[model samples]
Target: MTDQKSKDPLHGITLEMILTQLVERYGWGEMGRIIRIRCFNNDASIKSSLQFLRRTPWARNKVEALYLWYKRETAG
Candidate 1:
């Protein structure tokens, strides 16, 4: 067997960690403005955000984009 690993684009990362970082970098209010998604605009929470991201591919994409952007912009 080969000892190879498939990397996650969002590897070694948790959804809550991504969300927390985004919220810190952009703030929940601004995230809503930027993504214009309901999860950010209406009462945002870790559980709710995870639920949306798990089922909504487009929203998940946006969130992942935001994560990369945040990682770059903030030097995190």
Candidate 2:
């Protein structure tokens, strides 16, 4: 038997963790500009963003993509 690691960068990461890191790195203002979603643009909160992202697939995809980009950019 062989142990295989998951290739996905987000495999063990939760949406909350991703959102928290992004907020810490970019803040809500930049995040709004980056993704252009109401949740992040208007009265943004971690709880609200999490709810919105959980319900919206496209939005969630964008967030996940952004997280991956952030990770790659900061890898060094």
Candidate 1 residue spans exceeding 4 A from truth: 1-9
Model 2, C-alpha of 69: deviation from truth (Å) = 0.5
Which residue ranges in model 2 land beyond 4 Å of their true spot? none
| Model 2, residue 46: C-alpha shift (Å) | 0.3
For each candidate, what TM-score against the reference? Answer: 0.79, 0.96
Q: Write candidate 2's Cα lDDT for 1-76 as tens digits.
A: 9999999889989999999999999999999999999999999999999999999999999999999999999996
**Model 1 per-residue lDDT tens digits across residues 1-76:** 8887657668778877888888887888899999988988899877898899989989988899988887787675
- Leading candidate by TM-score: 2
**Whole-structure CA lDDT of model 2:** 0.97
Q: What are the clashing pairs of model 2?
A: none
Top lDDT: which candidate number? 2
